[model samples]
Target: MKQKMLAKAVGIALVMAPLASQAAVENIQYFGYAKWGNIYTDNDDHNNGKGERNDVIRASEGYGNYRLGNELNWWEAGLKADVWQDGDAYFDTTLYLGSGESWGDVSIIQMWSAGHGLFASQPNAKVWAGERFYRRHEVHMIDIKYWDTSSTGIGIEDWDLGFGSGHIAWMAPNSSADGRSLHNIDARISDIAISDTADLTFGLNYIFTQNSSYEESDITTSGAMLSALYRQAWDYGSNTFAFQYGTNALAGGLMSAEGGSNRKYSTGVEHDGYSWRVFNSGDLNVNEDFQVMYSIAYQDKNLDNNDGEKWFSVGARPQYSWTDYMATALEVGYETVEAQNGAGTNDMYKVTVAQMFQAGKGVWARPSLRIFATYSEKNDEWNRGGDTYGTAMRNASGKDSVDEVTFGFNVETWW
Candidate 1:
């Protein structure tokens, strides 16, 4: 029901945001992002959910989160207000809460509001509506994101289209899988600087299947995707590259375009697909007690049934400081997946070495306090244990290769 009336109008606008900001709220702000962790693994053969080293040696499932102590007990916090104004025309609002993996389960995940210069010839345009996570871009050491078009309908964005900077939205999807009745549209033309440190963007995502019984054949319920991104900045860090293409029903936007396809849309020949990626992580301060944070990724996925996947990943997380709050961090990661219908290649390698007590000194300093130990090695066909003795190990400690050892502690913060 329109997402329960937009969650009851975001709970009545956070309960009328302090009586509507005491009549025309001027400004308000608060923000947060967090990560919490707990991991313990030591090979508990079979039922792979207990030793849960995130299902034994991670990364390669929609590929993101490349095991850097893979922290994921998420959190987000928010507030941003600037209620009512009229000159440049204003209304601004933002509210986020988010939390996952328990903790009394919270929710909100942004509630929107926008108005900014309601067109006096597009005074830097803005016009918005509820629920959003729009404009997202990330790659923080394989934490993945390369443009997002989060949903909940309604949009219009920064328009200074002197060549770039434009957007569009019209969501309505929150779920679907044969339950049909979907619609999504996202478009963009971002940044576009292209020099003095580069910038460029282009995007599009379209989905359709507003079934009325497909209204008499609608191209088998359309789907489209196309994307491009390129960024470069170097004073220390910044690098990203992406490319995508899709067909048929891509409903899940684009996670580097799909290689774990279970998607079967019968006729339409599985709607061809392709993806691309490249990365270089952040905070590369190479001096002053050594600092680093690196990441490299190469992705290739071509879908149409089964048989197409190619992924390569590389990781880094070096830190060395014995002063400014103590430090020592070492994280190494490796990944390989090459399949072309033969189940022929698989690889995983990890190493985590931590003992830090940080707060400041490169690597985006953080609420760092880690005490870790991790070790990994894989390729027991990457543990596919459907056993009865179909062997993915664990028939009386069968195995040849498959190893793990983990111990964790992590805490991350952002504001």
Candidate 2:
């Protein structure tokens, strides 16, 4: 009896020891967010030539298209796990899942590792490889990822420079063709303070490709972009100004889009062109109960042998808190676009009134439920024979103008 008991105890100890050791080497975490709601519109079928059930309330900002429950619009969720860690070195991965016509699948969006003091004497200097989000910056309201350099490759971040910290990275597109590939070099200098309340950042991105699908010649195609940003912080809010310029293919933002049809210009077409943009966003606190958020942007695209396009947009949102958990808000936006070749020019405007419920009265409060009513209008050019909106409107109601009213509830939170 004693010998049998001893054997069993030894086996259990051996199993438990390995389990404990494994636990010590790995740490895991999970995070995600979901936003869903129902919308009712007066022109669901564009019976008035307004448009085909325009569910989007306005074009102010955010991933609003993700909230539409149609095949193209659906909810999103993601999971992240910090699978391993040791001192300053660790491994992590993220998976993104969504349901929609645009995204109805699971994708491993992030998988990478990093460490400090591994390559140099800088305390926080780090090096990493694999696939990652790279350096993506955006304006939340406009839904514009102005500066995105994410790809599969390697990089060094937090390298100390005399004036500020710097980062350098290389990224490449995945391809199966023999001896054919597109690669980019992205570099930036960040956190260069000019004053107690202000700072600046600068970036350069360049791309070179061999045997690209967009090229007919046997030579390489190349492009480059430059960007600068200035930021100022005050007691109540913050302000940011950003500017960018590049050749048609030089702009990294356009290249990051997956499909050829998703690109700014048509696929398999070689064109010499230039693009530029200026953008500003800010927030202001009027007092203990009132606050305002605003943004404006102007962008231009020109090709050597094609008609150009230009866009201008502005928007503002103001909120008045009735109590710690209740608030009222008014949002207004306007946008105009023109084609250089006289294809057409269109204008749009929107307004929304909302009642919000949340944990606090602050402007940044989250986990909020909002009930809203939106009103929007578009010019005849956008209603008759324009793009998708115009085609849908003409097909549905054959109208030259549209007045739409929508009511819906939305809830948003993150942790």
CA lDDT of each prediction against the hidden true structure: 0.65, 0.61
Range of the 10 consecutive residues with the lowest summed lDDT in candidate 2: 62-71
TM-score of each prediction: 0.32, 0.77
- Supply candidate 1's per-residue lDDT for 373: 85
> RMSDs, each prediction?
20.8, 9.2
Model 2 CA lDDT for position 93:
49
User: How many pairs of residues collide in each model?
Assistant: 0, 3
Q: Give the per-residue lDDT digits (tens) of candidate 2, residues 1-415.
A: 6675567557545633443455543444455554555556677554355443434533211111112111113454454444456565555545444443223232445556665456536867777787776877766555455676666789888898978899999987532222346677889999898999999999988776645654356222666788899999999889999999977455223332111113322213344577788879888888889998788877776766444456677888888999999999887877766654555556667777888898788556787688877777765342323331111122233224667777677776655
lDDT of 1 by residue, 203-248 (tens): 8877665653543343346667777777787876666666666554
How well does candidate 2 score on lDDT at residue 280? 94
Model 2: lDDT of residue 156:
89
Clashes in model 1: which pairs?
A: none
